[model samples]
Target: MSTLTFRSVSLRYPPRAARAGVGEKLVLDGIDLQVASHELVAIIGRSGSGKTSLLNLAAGFLEPTAGTITVDGVPIEGPSADRAVVFQDDALYPWLDARDNIALPFKLKGVPLAERRARAEQLLARVGLADAGDRRIWELSGGMRQRVGIARALAAEPRFLLLDEPLGALDALTRTRMQEFLLRIKAESGAGALLITHSIEEALLLGTRIVVLSPNPGRLTAEIEAGFNAEVLNGASVAAVKASPIFKRMHAGLTGLIHASAEEEIAA
Candidate 1:
């Protein structure tokens, strides 16, 4: 199994030229995180807690000011097919249909057209978009577009998925449905997932492990093991698992924890 590791990672940004005399701002500090091929780790925090920064670091869009990020012990040099990212905007190419969008990755690698088309078809089916391959990006629903985006990511055969609030833009009912879809897709893809979400419930429901960060130079403040995802994956319905007493208790506790952290930050 592959593992993505972040050790004592920190990120800081210098003040913009327009902000004269302002000191550099620290975004993340001393972060240590890991995600294995078999795990989905959800990270939660309030605004300015560096949640997106952390994901960006893992994606190699930005290097840490200090510390290292590695996959299977080798430092990440830059973005690679080893880690695929999904954004909230469902970043699909409108000019192309879903199939061609997914096939674009293969085309870049110079794969034969027929082979790429076949692989793209397989991925569309995998994401439950079997008949939507020819659908235009603008013609699909928000959820459908997101599925296509995910299918495109999987076409890269990445060892890890870096999700930056991929479902945050969907409507409530759609978001709920997509949550389950994410669980199933993550399992089927066999790629470790690092999800950044603002919803404590989302983190609890989907994460094998939930990590909380405290703001003002974000730091890891809490890590909780969650079994709700496993229960749902093991045949318990999402509604049933969510309605259970344990699930309710954990959700409430996580809510309190995040609120308390924010309060503390404000008081400081």
Candidate 2:
């Protein structure tokens, strides 16, 4: 199995000239994390906790100020097809239909037209959008659009998925359904995932391991092992798994942990 590792990683942005006498702002500090193939690691924390920063580092969109990030021991230099990212906004091209959008990655790689088209069709089916391949991006619902985005990401055949609040934009009912869909896709695709979310319930429901980051220079503060995702994959209903006592307890504990961190930050 492949492993994505962040070793003592930290990020600091230079102080703006306008902020006279202010030192550099530290965003993340001493972060050590690993996401292995087929494992979903969910990251949860309050705003300003650098959850998105962590995801960006993994995506190679931003470099850390210290330490290193690697996939199977090779240092990451910049964004590559090996790590696919799905954002809250679908980011689909309005000019292209769903199928063509998914095929865009392959097209970039110089894959022939016929091959890319065939592969795009397969991904459409995988994401349960088999008949929506011809649909216009503007015509699809928010959930449908996100599915297309995910399919496009999978087109890269990446080793890891960096999901940045992919479901945060959806309505309550759709978000609930998408949670189950995500678990299924994670299992079927066999790609490790690093999900940055604000929802404690989401972290508990989907994560094989939930990691918490404390703010004001985000640091890994807690890690909790969870099996709810595996339970769903094993044929248990999402509702059933969520309603269990252990699930509720963990959710409460995580909520308290995050709230306490926020309170402590305020008191300081």
Q: Model 1, 115-188: lDDT tens per residue? A: 99999999999888899988899999999999998989998889999999999999999998899999999998
* True-structure RMSD, every candidate: 1.6, 1.6
Candidate 2: which stretches are off by over 4 Å?
Answer: 14-23
Which clashing pairs does model 1 show? none
Error of 1 at 132 (Å): 1.2
User: Residue 155 error for model 1, in Å?
Assistant: 0.4
Question: Which parts of model 1 have CA positions greater than 4 angstroms off?
Answer: 15-21
Q: What is the lDDT of every predicted structure here?
A: 0.93, 0.93
How many Å off is the CA of 259 in candidate 1? 1.2
